[model samples]
Target: MISQTLTLELKQVLGALLFGSRRPISVADMRRVLLEVAEQNGDVGGRFAQTSA
Candidate 1:
């Protein structure tokens, strides 16, 4: 699970990105963004698809 601190940070960034878009953020887009953030934060070790660590 993403720490509370990390989740807040990601939400802030995601909010900014979403607000900048012409349309609402889609589920796929959000998932892609979150997965990217998870990789950067080294929080993907728990998921089989993200076992790159």
Candidate 2:
């Protein structure tokens, strides 16, 4: 599980990205941005997982 601080930071980052955008962002784009942020912060471990759902 990720820490609360990291979660909050991610939320803030996501919010900034979303709020600053003029056009709608796609899921793939958002996921890529989030992964970039996580990787930058050295939080790219098991934080991202692919499910067949």
Best by TM-score: 2
Top of the candidates by lDDT: 2
Please report, in order, the local distance difference test score of every candidate based on alpha carbons: 0.58, 0.60
Give the Å error, residue 21, model 2. Answer: 1.0
Local error of candidate 1 at residue 1 (angstroms): 33
Expressed as tens digits, the lDDT of each residue in 1-53 for candidate 2 is 87564343545666887999999987777777766665666654225322111
Estimate the overall C-alpha local distance difference test score of candidate 2.
Answer: 0.60
lDDT of model 2, residue 35: 66
Taking all chains together, each candidate's TM-score versus the true structure is 0.48, 0.56
* 5-51: candidate 1 lDDT, tens digit per residue: 43336446568778888988876776676676666666442232242
TM-score of candidate 2 versus the correct structure, residues matched by position: 0.56
* Candidate 2 positional error at 52, Å: 12
